[model samples]
Target: MIKWVAAFLGYFLFRFPGAVLGFIVGTFLDNFGGSGNKASSVFQDYTRQSVSPADFELNLLSLCSIIIKADGQVNQRELDYVRQYFLSTYGKEKANAIFRTFNEVIKKREVSAQRICAFMEQRTRYEVRLQLLHFLFGIAQSDGQVSKAEVEKLIEIAGYLRVGRNDFESIKAMFIEAADNAYKILEINKNATDDEVKKAYRTMAKKYHPDRVVTENEAIRKGAEEKFKEVQKAYETIQKERGIS
Candidate 1:
């Protein structure tokens, strides 16, 4: 929408110097609070403050790419996970911009992880860094397990974030334990029957039922959902592998 308006106004003001001024003013006002609309001020302010020195879009892409690399294979499922996350959180236009930035970041083989880590360390808040680490861990464990590569990079990023090694180990263990429990809940193993799968799903469905969690404690709902998804994925993987009916 902004781009369309900018293009139209730019075309209209092609010739005169005043036209350039008008376009600039108009674009700025449109983005800010033009036409007596101060609605976007808070959001704009937050974005400006959050992304001043380090480009937020570029940084996010770099972090996500590193996470994808962590899994060793960089599968379509992980790529899809990234795309869906950006689309849901940042909207399609910004998501496209970030993905383009990610492509550029991936091209530079000479880029230094340490320098990038330094930039992120200096720029973002501790809370935001923790959220990012959780997100990366969630992505790595999305397919019901975490690869060694994923574990390695998780540790690397945790160190860069200045999270203590002990803390990092604890967090990693927590998520991995959660993931393993999810797999167990689904009865994923070398031998499992169709009845066992159905029974396990029923048991987990009752255990992780969102209505129960939301009613009991809203705080646990999100974690429950993630855990449940892993259970489902493990079930699917086992079923596919064993050719279960």
Candidate 2:
């Protein structure tokens, strides 16, 4: 892990030669048992409370590429959505570098959702994974409508990410409108009583809260905020329809 983080920082900061230098340094640290305390504050910057943020960004790019191509037709709006997201979370220069890396590397590769999610499943927290779903859905729906191909691809990716079926359905309901979408977003059934509906709303509100995702990354926290809003919207929709407010 140290080696991976080091290599990323090296490359991100200095490109190829720096990557080799970083790998050598990381290997030395690992051999000397530096992970306990020898890891410098600089190293810790990459590996925060959770996985390496740099690593997460690379994996996120992979997933973004997959979803963008899912419908077989790439829309400019979808492309712009990704670009705008990066620009917002990271300043223009960093965002441009990130996208530069993406276009040069990730765009050329053959993305395998199963493989990407397999790594994410082990490394990512549940709340963070849920936020990933929300982000992907936004991509799929950015072009005014989500194609059938995109939906199927998203489901497959969710399965690989090991996201629970109900959780996936709950997020899906936010973007795909349906008669029972509000109930689904609450992870409840229409047959649920008013009391049960209230309970479900509480549960979902807690689950989707932005604070649930432990991350310093503004983009991820932003995604969680969006999910949290969807949950609130769902609860409101249900209350209005049932006259239970």
Candidate 3:
């Protein structure tokens, strides 16, 4: 059990900064316990745990710091959006702690978005990665518009994470309002027939629905819900435009 825990910690130690690794190790240890046969069982359990919500939260904040700083300046609106998101998801005390870590991460000159995204791809599930992309769009649009630089950075990070073009465009359209936003959000061509539009909408709705996220964490679930709502809004916009029932 100790060997497994040490190996896991070592993996993070190599990939993440000391402070983030410390927090992750602490969280894992806090959840760890048992003796003899029980200890072996616990080790097996821990090995199967994959990535916990705490792990996801820490990585998310770290990546967020990188995205916010992508444009060479971290705007107040972007920071405020992140704070409110943390507070809503983690409560005031935990949010403050994570926010402190985020600030610390951004101050370091060595942590790049490419490294972080690669690390996240190794640890996170597909749904969580999608949510991370969605969150980045939220951060980029916090100042009421997504800049070209932010879009480029997002594409770069998504590429590192191996997020598909269709999935990435689906999330992008949710934030960027334009005449063809509905088609982009559904990942369909603008020339689709009404039946094709309906099919696309159903497919996207199923893909982005909050229930599709296989996590018990309410925060993560809520983030998925927001994406699900965006999918719904896109479908509705297309329906209205085409006068489809």
Ranking by TM-score: 2, 3, 1
Look at candidate 3 and tell me the lDDT of residue 186: 85
Candidate 1 per-residue lDDT, tens place, 138-200, comes to: 778766788888898888888888765543543454368654443454544335567877787
Best of the two (1, 3) by TM-score = 3
Which sections of candidate 2 miss by over 4 Å?
Answer: 1-50
Q: List the residue pairs that clash in candidate 2.
A: none
For model 3, the run of ten residues with the poorest summed lDDT: 39-48
Instruction: Identify the candidate with maximal TM-score.
Output: 2
TM-score of each candidate structure, all chains considered together? 0.50, 0.79, 0.77
Question: What's the candidate order when arranged by decreasing lDDT?
Answer: 2, 3, 1
| Candidate 3 or 1, higher lDDT | 3
lDDT value, candidate 1, whole model: 0.59
Candidate 1, which ten residues in sequence have the lowest lDDT sum?
212-221
For candidate 1, the per-residue lDDT at 198 reads 71
Error (Å) of candidate 1 at residue 159 is 0.7
